[model samples]
Target: MTGLVEYAERHPWLTDAIVVAALLGSGVLGVHLVGPGDSRPEDVWVADAVTVVACLAVFGARTHPRATVVVTTVCAVVGGGLGFLLTPLLLAPVMVALYWLAVTTTSRTAWTYGAVTIVLVVGTAVGADIDETVALRSVGPALWLVLPLVMGSRSRLRDALLDAVRARAEHAERTRDDEARLRVTEERMRIARDLHDVVAHHLAVANAQAGTAAHLLRRSPELTQKVLADLQTTTSAVMLELRDTVGVLRNGGADEDGLEPAPGLARLPELIEACASAGLTVDVEVDGEPRELPAGIDLTAYRIVQEALTNATKYSASGSASLRLGYGARLIIAVANETRPGDPGAGRPGYGIVGMRERAHAVGGDLRVSDAGGRFEVVSSLPLHTPAATP
Candidate 1:
């Protein structure tokens, strides 16, 4: 069935040929039925010739709609003017032409041509003084002509509606693809931030512990051993975390037993111990009632503090910093450290501060960094309840 329809669509002229054959048969019948076969031979020949020309004109209606409608209407009126019966069969070609005109041309053009056709065809029939009733002379031709125009207009509207639906579906599919790409990009950036914070903070502490061990080697052998032990602990913990992170990437996910819990404020004591061994003393002060936080806010807070202390370890001349946390509608974190004019690591290029800010903002929070009054300070304000999707 589908193949047949496809074949018909491929040969469009076949449709015009079928319609023309039907019109010729009906025209012949209409002429013979005129007054008990009393139509003269000359009149019959002329009517048949005019009807054939009008039916042929139907073939061009799709290409030259207005011209085709005009030609068919003229032929139909000419046949009626020669004192022949004006029946619907005799006007079949004009009806077919009007239909194609409606389908191919604009509604305004089809209707304008239809009104002109009605005026010409009906006026010729009525003014010819035929024995046919008034209804046949005027209403019959108008009804026949109007049907094709109406059907053609409806076909055009349906086709336009289908095109609009197809276009909207395509646009939605493209939007879906764009949204998928955007999500992938955001995930990559989140992973980069997490890796930077985890690796940079741990490595800096390890480096500081190593330097301390070497500086104390000759003067304090026992303390050097303790620093070396702390160094070992730091490297071991970071390796386990690195493995955990990398294993997730390699295996698509971690097994339940293999997955390590992400770090949060509960792990701040461990961070304090590591920083103390690195010769950066962190004095932590809590201003409000401490409560457990949502995972996103907890992880973001931990990373911001870790990154800020790492910067202080690298850049501060004084080996002391203050860490403060306040809990209320929002969790407030502030880290301040003394800075001197000739701090050894003052002029280094790093993304630590930027990563910290990004982590804060990811949880619907904000971070501010300022170097004022001989001190460097990082203040972050985070909501206690963060969005579920934040990394």
Candidate 2:
């Protein structure tokens, strides 16, 4: 059914031919079946000729609706004037024209055109008094004319409603695609930040251990062995983290069981030992009772302290840093390290600091980095509890 409508739309001239055939066939049949019984041969010829002209006028109905209606209505009156009964079948051609007119134009235009045709056909049949029957002269022609106009208007309305529904569905599909793209972007950024933290912290500690081992190799061989052992531990730990980070690129996402427990505040002892191996001392302080923290906040807090001390190991004049954790209504974290002369004037922060800020904001918290007069400090506050759903 859909294919046939598309074909008709593509070839309008072919559609016009089909309509002319149906209307002409019905008109000729009506003339033979319902004409006057004692009609002359010439009267039959004239009535048939008028029917042919009316059917042909339907071709122009789609493009010139008003003109086509007038022509067909005039032809209908001419046929009725010649002692022919106004049967609906004989008026099929005029009805076809009105149907096309209604479908192609607005309701007001179609109604105005249909009313004029009805008035002309009915008034002429009654005025001529050629056919005396009440139904044939007055009722039949008016009733048939109105049917096609109603059908055409109904089809037009149905088509308009279908198009609106199709447009809405397309808009919803586009919205879903946009949301999917945004989610993918956020995931990519998270993986990049994690990769940076794992690589930077481990490499800094390993490099410091390797340098310390070289300095003590000839002077004291026993001390060099312990430094080399710490180097091996740092390398092994970094390799495991690197595999986990790379697994995200291999698989679309990490499965719950495939992941190790994420790094957080519980890992601080290891971070301090690694900094100790690098010849930097980290002093830990706690205010209020220390307790378990949310996974996201814990990981963010650990990364900030690790990054601050790692910077100190590479650049601090004092070679020592301070870490303070305050557990109150909100968890407060602060890490400070002494800076060398004219070091870190705070023009633009490095990727490590940027990553730390992004992690804090991701968990609905805030972090700030400041370099004030020989000291670099990172301070952040986080909500202790997440909103839970009620059963």
Candidate 3:
């Protein structure tokens, strides 16, 4: 039952055919009522032929309604005086035609054709000795012809409704996709900020310590050796943190096993040694007790020192630099190098500094770079306990 209803709704042609059959059957009943009284043999034959032609017109009503109306009208005119059989059936074909015209043509055309049909049917009755009242009554019910017009109008409305629904659905899908892209863009920005914080601070501290070691080596070789050991530890710490930050990209989580911890304030001495080897003089002053920091804070401090010293290696004219690390709830690191008059690294500030700043910001830290009296300095401070803090 469900399938049948669905098919009928979708296929207007099927409904139209059913309506045509019912209308034709009604026409046959009308003829039966009018009777074949006093009809001669030849008259009966012509009447039957006309009646058959009119009923058949209903069959093609949907495809060529206007043509069917014309054929039925001609048959009505020819058989008017002869018999009522063909004349009664005329209303069926005319109604079907009007319905089709209203469906396929303008309302004006349908109304015009409807007026002509009413006039012709009425006139034939008056001229053929049939009562004018009876003829009017016979054709009045053909107003059911307007069914196709209603159906067509409704079909157009249905199509418009379906189109609107599809458009809204597409708009919703597009909105969903746009929002997803926006989320990804915000996440990348956050990650970049973390990287800057972690890198800038550590690099700065390492640069300062290395400078201290280089200066002390000329006076006390034993103290220089101790500083070198500390510098090595700082380098190891920075390398570990660097690996963690990079690992986040390769493996999408913070808690993957088999990953090494990042370097933090604990590795400051090693950082100084690496800088000393790179020909930088460094110094260290500790004001606060060394305590564990969040991974992000540790990494940020390390990166800042690394980038500052890298900048020094590239640009320091005297081949000497300074490093400072102040640890607290937050870690502060600074590295500075004197620019040589003709050093290739002095004239250009490169990606090293830019990369450093980005790392500081990632860890919720701020980085500052400046040149004073031919000395380039970088400083960054980062908070502990930031989320996604790598160890």
Residue 82 in candidate 3, Cα distance off native in Å:
6.0
**Where is model 1 more than 4 Å wrong at Cα?**
8-42, 84-88, 115-133, 136-139, 340-349, 387-391
What's model 1's TM-score?
0.85
Expressed as tens digits, the lDDT of each residue in 222-242 for candidate 2 is: 999999999999999999889
**Candidate-wise lDDT, in order:** 0.85, 0.83, 0.66
Q: Lowest-scoring 10 consecutive residues by lDDT in candidate 2?
A: 33-42
What tens-digit string does per-residue lDDT give for candidate 3 at 1-391?
A: 9998789869977776786677667665545545435443345556556666776776676677678767766666555555454343446666556656666665566667666765666566556456545645445433443444466455545667888999999999999999999989977876765565455545655675688688998998998898777767766766777788788777787655856566665676765666665556566666577677777667667656766666776567776777777767677777887886655656365566676777778667888888767887888877766856469
Best by lDDT: 1
lDDT of 1 by residue, 202-308 (tens): 89999999999999999999999999999999889888888887887789778998776778999999998889999999999999899999887898899999998
User: Quick one: ranking by lDDT, best first?
Assistant: 1, 2, 3
User: Cα lDDT for residue 359, model 1?
Assistant: 84
Runs off by more than 4 Å, candidate 3: 9-27, 35-90, 93-139, 170-391
